[model samples]
Structure formats: structure tokens, C-alpha cells
Target: MEAHSASYLRWIVVLLLVSSCIEATSFSKVKHKNAYATMMYVGTPRDYEFYIAVRVLIKSLSALNVEADLVVIASIDVPHRWTQALEQEDGAKVVRVENLDNPYKHQNNFDRRFKLSLNKLYAWSLVDYDRVVMLDADNLFLQKTDELFQCGQFCAVFINPCVFHTGLFVLQPSMEVFKEMVHELENGKENPDGADQGFISGYFPDLLDKPMFHPAPNGTKLNGSYRLPLGYQMDASYYYLKLRWSIPCGPNSVITFPGAPWLKPWYWWSWPVLPLGLHWHEQRRQTLGYFAEMAVMLIQSAIYLGIIAMTRLVRPSLSKLCYRQSDKSINLVHNSLKLVALWCIVAAYVIPFFIIPYTVHPLLGWSLYLLGAFALCSIVINTFLLPMLPVLVLWLGIVGTLMVMAFPWYPDGVVRALAVFGYAFCYAPILWASMVKITAGLQLSLEREAFLPRLGEPWPPSSFKLY
Candidate 1:
């Protein structure tokens, strides 16, 4: 009786283990058919802000416990590893798609973009999905939005009183609709935005009609719907306009950054520290920390401010410490050094063209080369082509990027070490001189004052003018 009892216990344990295995498999493998989908497209990882936002959107969805099917339609430009992360980490089904043909390919920044606005049209081609919620990567979800799946074939939010925002929309996927939309695009019916939103809005112009109308699925009823609530797609830019004291429109589910792409949340410097800043902070993406990034900015700003500060604070001390030298020689030597430094910095940027010209598209390669050359020439030779501050920011950003990339294409030597240092000092003395001139209330007419133009701007006209 004891032996029989022990045998039965062992058999029971085996049955329990097998049952648990089956249960685990059932839980992990959710079927795609008849499930609602939230779809995004990623063509490149180069757009750091958009990429981070996309990750946050997926993570937020998981946090909300919304089991909607996650899908990413991607182009070949997006790396396979990203597709793997979407599948394994975010539970997404990544469908590879070819970039749509663009008649404006050469003239316009359409599908050939870090913008990738054209890729959104691919959502219409997802015939397998029961319903699709298309979201631009620049959006963040605040709460669970699974109920949107219950929405009709088309549903969107209207941020403006009249114009509906296309960043977020709910639609049923259909190849028939996709082909027709493509046909419309082919015939040049794109909206003013010149993105996929343009083509979509043109195709379905009656979005604002009361009891909104949308395409029926295979002779299904012409289902009409209500507008998506204002809170569903909150444009944070409206904080200064309409939402002053509180979010006047009630609780928000999704926040959309509909402004210039550069002003996105990841760029902490552009956003202020109040209602807008805190919302972005709450998202708390596991990135190189904002404060850490701020520290970098602070260091950069200090370097900038130091020059300005010195110009104001050190005039009394400057004459005390050193003998008066020939001002023209000082200006000429310092300016020449700055020009050399600027050249090294631009050359550092142009290094990629030298190293990986074959990998990049020919047009891109030549464009980068030409652009870098123009920047270098602008500072040293052609001063008035582009304004100074914008060029300075571009130069600094490029230098910072090269520092992070560790000057990869550069040859390792003492020469490389000197080149790096040379790039850092590009604006050092010039910025100081410019500030000194500004503090002293000097006129900086570039055409009239040859010294300031050659030596770099805003400096007081030298009494001992080189000319």
C-alpha cells in the first residue's frame, strides 16, 4: 500500500508540470487575428528623439496592461536589431515594407526622411488586423486606450477648432483603401503638409462631419462615429494659448508634440520646467539622464558664458597683467588660429565622407561634403552666407557628436590629439572678443569693419586698424 501511494504521488506531480507548461504556452502566444492593433513605422534609428518616443509609447502601453497587438512597419534602413527589440522586448509584430514611390522624391523631403511621414500610409495595407490605431512616434500615452478599438473604421482628434490633428487616428485596415489612397497620392492630391497626413486628409475630407462617416468593411453598415475627445490628443503647445491654469479640457490620455520636430521632449533645454517639462519627466525614459545631459549643456554654456563674462569682468585686470601689444598682430594671429581650428572641426565632420563614402548614398555623400565645405568657407571666407549663431550651434553640435563618437574615423596619433584640442578651441578667443566689443558698445558693421570680419565679429573696431 505504501509503494502504490508513492507511485501515485509521482504521477500526479508529472501531470501538474505538463499542465503548467500548456498554460504557460497559452498565455504567451496571443493570436493576432481579430485583435486590435497599434501600429508604428520606423525607417531609421538616426532620429534619436522619435526613437525614444516610440520606445516610451510601447512601454506605456504595456504599463497600462493593454493587450492590443503591437505592430511596427519598418523599412530596410531600420536595423534588424531594432526589429528584434520590438518583437522580443515590446511584443510587437514587425512587418517589413518597401518605401512608397515618391514623384517628389528629388524635390521634396517626403518618404526619404527621418520624417518618414509617408510610411504611415502603410497602416491602411494591414488587411489582417480587425482595427488599427495609427500613432506618430512623437506622441506619449498617459492612460489605457484599449476602448479606442471599439471606435469605428475612422476616428481622430481635432485640436484646432476646425482642423483635425492626424498624429493619432483609429481606422480599420484594408488593402482596397490602401490602393486607392496610393492612387490618390500618385495623381498629386496631397494636402499642404506634404506628408502622409496630407494624402489621408484629402482622401477622407469629411472627418469633421457630424456623425462622422468612414469606409464600410465588405458591405458592412456605413458606421458613423463621434469625434475623439479633446483629451485623447492634447497638444502640449496649447499650454500658453488655451490651457493656462489647468488642463481646461479634463484628463488627458495621450500627449502629442505637433510642433517643430527639434522641439520634442527629449531635448530638455528647449522645454521649460513647469507643466510641460514635468509631463516629459514622468515618462522617465531610461536614457542618458536629463540632468546628465544638462550637465553637458551647463558645461558648454559655461564655456560660452565664460568668454562673455571675461569681456565684462576682466577689462581692469587685462591691462594690469600684460603689457600693451600690437592689437592688429594679436587680432590677426588669434583669428588665423580660430580659422584653422574651425577647419579642423569641419574636417572632423567631413571625415565620415572620407571613411564611409561607399556606404552612404552618392547624393548624401556629396551633400554632406558640400555642406561641410560651405560651413568652413562661411566662417573663414564667405561670412555673410549664413548667420553666425545658427552656424555656431551646428558646429558645436558636430564637435560634441565627434567627441562622443570618439573621433572614430580619425587615425590614432599625437596629431589626432592636437586636432581634437584644436576643434575645442574653435570659438574660444573669438567669442571672448565678440563679447568684449558688445560690452564696450562697439559697432560691428561687417562690411565697413574689415578687422571684425577677418578676426570674427562684434569686436570693437581697432584704433590701429590693419587696413
Candidate 2:
């Protein structure tokens, strides 16, 4: 029985080896097909922000049910937490690579924001795929773009009149082209802008004049570089001009926010100001949700509530100490108390601005800030017996300034900056006048014993300490 079992095991091993060889031979002839690819790297201040943006893009693509694999060419330095989230949560295949050296770093005009941006060049090394659509995180897709795989060796949209936008482009993977690109970089090739945009644009200088690409219906991949219609990459700025899309060719499929980094659609406050931002947030609401920020927001809300309650409880005592009518000998003490009250009011507004998370949904962010400011200002108001309007003018000014800056009607960024400066210039005098009014009111209250009944209680000894 033992001899027979040994004979059966040997036969099984031989059959397995033969089958593996046959499968390997057959697999060598099959192409791996296509993928939608983007890159992620560290060394920038906005690393986490970009990471969140990329995950949203990947999840959005999955929601569209595009007929391609999702790929991320991430640098090895990127945290395991982010890469794991991309793989397990967002359904992305992450390929880790070393950061590509940018030879143009010594150039006078090199922008540090692109320090690790050259890592994007690794997209061409993805030779396993027959075709790849390389993208920037800021690209918002409105529809499935599976047809992009049928384009040629290189295809891009010309959002600018003379230059194609790299925010979204189709490229066929080839080791030779990738090697030549690295060679050109090492040889100090003339990259006018010293960033990935200028380097890639310089490498494909004639794409602007190429004939537009039209994907073959029979699913045949074409050859040569071609220009994609503007519809494939409608700049976000275009929609702001008309408040709607009017692209007349191809598919009005992707929106690229290439203007300002801070105004990316994923940011909660970007919406209503940029109406299209609401669409991006809607996608996020469905897919990723806001759970990541919910805990911090709740904690802040509770702290604000505690502050308001504690201030209310201590109101009569604070008022008794500070709001009493004084003789000439107590005038120095009175002036010092007034300065301290003003400082506390200023801190009330400033403290909340920093404590609130920078990327929380705009509505939540604004709401939390208002709550915190109101809570802190209550201490000052109850103690000094001051009016509400003067304390809140500064808060109102900040909100108004944000609205002015976010107005979508500005023809260009230059106009937007000028408008913000104009608003500040006009509002500075008003803010100063409000501060003077607050000071005057506080002084008058200190000289009168009957400012408010709650504050008219007998004062403690002059040496009394809050501590």
C-alpha cells in the first residue's frame, strides 16, 4: 500500500510541472489590456490633501464602472496607511517605485511644488498594460471613458489654445520611450518651466498641430500621437465663465481644476462658490463619506458647548469684579482691565480659526468656527456688559472676505486677487472704527454703576485674584 501511494504522488508532481509550463507559455502571448493610472508621492505640504483627492478620483471612477483597472504609481516614501487605503478601500492596484530625480532642480525658475512631481514619469514603465490613461488628482469625471483605451501611442486635450493639458492623457506603455525620457532629463534637456508640464510638453512639441483622435468602433488601437478634443478635458474655469458646459465636440466627460490648489472640488467650502464643487462633494458623500472628519468635529462641538455653559455660570462673578464704578485712584486699574477685556475678545475670534480642521466640509467648518467664537465671546460680553454687534463685526468681515474671494464671476485669478484687495482696503477703516467704538463703550460702562443690574453687585477687594 505504501509503494502504491509513493507512485501516485510522483505522478501528480510530474503532471503539475507539465501543466505549469504549458500555462506559462500560453500567458506569454496574452496582453494585460488597459488601466486608468495616477501617481502619488510625498515631500509636499499638501501630501495628505492630494492623497484624499486621488482616492476620491479612484472611487468616482469605480462608481462610473469604467471597463479598466485602476492603478496608482506611488512613490515608496508614501505612508503605508495611504497606500493600504487606496488598495483595500478604493480598489486600486498600487505600484511602488523610487522617486525619479529631477535634473532641472538647479534651474532658477524651478517650483518646489513639483519636487516629487517627476515621479509621474513612471506611468510609461507600466508596460504590462496595452494602454494607460495617466491623470492628475484634480480631474473630475462625469462619465465612463473606456473609449480612451482605443487612442494611439499618445493623445491629449488642448485646453489652452497652444498647449495640451497633461491633467488627463492617454499613453501606450513602452520601455524605449520611458528610457529616452530619462536620458533627455539627465542630459539637461531644455524644459522651459522646470516641471513635469514643461518637460512633457517640450518632449511632444508638435502635438498641438496633430489631427484629432477618433476611437475606432471595431476596438482596434490606432498608431501615432493625436490631439484630443477640448471636451475630454474641459477646464473648470470655462464653466465659471458661463455657469454651464458648452463643449461642442467629443464628450464633455472630464473637468480639470487647474487654476488654484486650495479651491479643489474635494474641499467642502469650494462649493456654492463653484457650483460644480457640489457635484464632487456629492460623489464623495456617496462613496468615501465624511467619517474621517466626524470625530474631530464632534469633539470641537462639545468643547464649544462646555465653554458657553461655563462662561454663563461664571457671568455674575466676572461682572462684579470688572464693571463697578471707580474713583480717580482706581483709574489705572480700570484702563488695564479694559485692555485685558479687549485682548480676550480678539482671542475669542482667532482661537477658533486655528483649532478647526482645515479640510472639514465648509458648512461644518463655518458652523464650528461660529460656535466656538460665540462661546468665547460670551465670557467677554457678560463680564464687560458689551453689545453683541461690535464683537461680531470681525467675524462677519472674515466670512464676507471669503465670499468675495470665492466669487466665480472673476474672469481670471488676477481679477479675483484685485477684488479681495479692494474689499480689504474698504473694510479696514470699518473694522478699526468698530474697535474704537467697543473701547469707548467699555470705558463709559466702567464709569457708570448702573450699566446692567446683574453687573451692579458690590465688588470684591482690589487684591482679589481669579486664580
Candidate 3:
């Protein structure tokens, strides 16, 4: 019995090793047949936003060592210089289609918003491959997803209950289907969501109701249905959902940004408005890290509350706390600009950190984010915030910058300005506290004129402090 058992175990081990080799070979063949594609529509000029995103996708693909052909479809407005760079530098087959004239409306905000949905159909023009995966430019793949190519030509994630997010999908390129879709659009077919997603779902209306089965690259049949393992096409905003527990596990292949246009990862200014950016650091961390980013956000929130407290609660208490009140009329516009500069200063610093993850090709995004941040900051600061300290900081910065400029080896004045503005921006907490106190005093002077009762005064702040 022992001899037979030993022989059986040996046979099982041999079969497992043979199966592994067979699967590896099958994956290689799938790579040769499958391709990854993205679409770019530029009606006015070059779209550096999409280019930046596409570059990251290519870099990530290289990092993951994915074995699929990368393809890009662009509109005529996009310059060949950029396309050639994409092809030569990033190894992409960029096909420029004539600027398509698409006129379709869904009678909603999203559908009536953008005029470029029809450009995505160009993916079907590439019939050279047996299968293709369409990934949005705003997506980042965290792990190898060569397995997705194994799914059927119509595999996608069931994003919400019955709806599928079209940000990521697998489909076989067919010119015939593309033509039919164009015909339908020309014939006034309506898409409720108003984008390629809505239009494509119109083609597979019953996709949400049914589960599909197809062959994997390993020559084994598997379920190709709308799969939602939370491991693929994870919406970045989904991390912000207030749930008890959402620790990352298993294989999270793609991180999708299905957020508003302003919330795109490239738009760093939006981070200050929505704390959703906190989850970004959390997602990239191991061991859960105890929500360290959220702690920072909480501090940010507390600072915001402290401002409100000074403006609302503390101002009223000054009367009861033996504070002398005198009339001091102030310019409303000046104070308003002070508020603007106060907020803009935060955005200026916060924006730079957002682009740190994309070290490559970060120059454009960083400079743009900083310029925009500073332009807005300057407008607000020069307008208000009383550049008293900032101007001094700036002068010292100018001295330092001039020294750097004296050295022929240093970068341009613009780079030096970031360093100056960076130090100048650091005076937020002091400025914010002083601004709130000053503004609150002015507010109280105005409140007496309105004949409104004083808001109940909370205890003095110093009394509450534990020494």
C-alpha cells in the first residue's frame, strides 16, 4: 500500500509541474494576440493632460512587465510631434483619425457636456489583434492584469448594483460593430450617461443581467461574465466611501478615477476642497498604516474649526471677558481677499505634494500646478492677506534666489520662485489665526449695528488648555 501511495504522489507532482509550464506557454501566446488601447481627442490643441496620464500608464505597464501591444487612437487636432514622441519614446501605435463630427445628446449634464464620445469608436479600426482591452487614460494599474485578456471579448466590472463602469473593459475589435454603432449614433440613439460608456452599454444592454463564460489564456475555460472582485478597476473615489473597513486585499489590478473632471488626479487644487486625497496615501501604504493621512486631514479640519471658533464664538466672548471694543471700519473687499489668499496658500503647498507620485514627466504638471497655485495665491495675497510678513519673506527669498542665480549652474528664476513662494507659503497658521482674529473683531463692530444678540460665549481657550 505504501509503495502505491508513493507512486501516486510522484505522479501528482509531475502533473502539477506540467500544468504550470502549459499555463505559462499559453499566457505567452495570449500576449502576442492581445493589445491594450486608449483614445485621445484634441479638437483645439494638444491635450497634455491625456498625454501625462497615458505616459504613466505606459510606464506602469513597463514596470509590471505586461506583454501586450500598446495602441493609441487620436483625433486630427492632436499634433504628430506628440504622437511621434508617444510612439518612439513610449512604444505605442498612435493612429490619428480625422476629427470626427459627432452630434449626439442625452438631454442630461454628462451627455451634453463633452463632444468627444464618438472618437473612441476608432479602437475598432485596429482589426489586426484577436482581442483588445480599452483602458481610460485616467487609470493606473497596480498589478499585472494579463489575466483580463483571458476573459471574453465583453468583460467589464459591475460598478454599481446593475451598472458597469466603462472606464475599463475587454472587447474584440470589429469594424462591423463599430460601423453599426456609428450608424446608431447618427440615427439618434440616446445614451443616458452621455459618454462612450453610455453608448457602449447601449450595444450590450443585457450585459448586467447575464454572466458570460469564455476561454482563458491557459487554454482553460472560465467565467468571463461581468466580474466585480474589487480587484479590478477600483474607482479612486471609492476609497473615500465612509465604510467601517476597506483594507486592500487580494489582487487590486487597476485603480480608476471615475471622479468629476475637477477631481482628476492631475487636478491637485481640488484636494483641499475634498479630503478624498487622504485616501491616496492610504491606498499606497502597507499594514494599513493606521490611517495616518486621515489624522492629517483631521488636523486640517480642526484648524478650519479654530478659524470658525475665532470668527463666531470667541469674538462674542470678548465683551464678557473685559475686552475694550472700539469702532474700526474696514474695507470688505480687502478682508475678502485676505480670506481668499488664506485658502489659496493651502492649495499652493497641497498641490505640489499631489504630483510627487508621478516623478517622471512631472515637470509640466508640477510647474503648472505651482504656477496656478501661486497665481491664485498672489491674486489673493496682493489683493488682501496684508503681505506684511510675506513680502519680508519674499525679499529674503529673493536674496537667496539671487545668490542661486549668481551661480551659473542653478536653474531658472521660475524654479527659484517656487523655493521663495514655498517658504512664504509656510506662514499659513500664523496668518490664518491673525486674520481670523482681525476679521472677527471687524465682524463684531459690524454686528452691533445689526442689533443681533451675541452668540453665547464659550469658556476662554486658555482655561481649557491642560498644562
Which regions of candidate 3 fall more than 4 Å away from where they truly are?
1-31, 44-46, 105-113, 212-228, 242-250, 270-433, 436-467
Instruction: Give the top-scoring candidate (TM-score).
Output: 2
lDDT of 3 by residue, 327-413 (tens): 232345335534554465556446545533331122233334443444434433333323434523433343443344333332434
Candidates sorted on lDDT, descending:
2, 3, 1
Q: In candidate 1, how many Å is residue 212 off?
A: 7.3
Q: Please, what is the TM-score per model? A: 0.54, 0.79, 0.56
lDDT (C-alpha, whole model) for all candidates: 0.53, 0.79, 0.54
Cα lDDT tens digits, model 1, 36-83, are 333345545444445455655666666677756676666546667766
Worst 10 residues of 3 by lDDT: 315-324
lDDT of 2: 0.79
User: Which residue pairs collide in model 3, if any?
Assistant: 111-194
Q: Give the winner by TM-score: 1 or 2.
A: 2
Deviation from native of the Cα of residue 32 in model 2, angstroms: 5.7
Q: What TM-score should be assigned to candidate 3?
A: 0.56
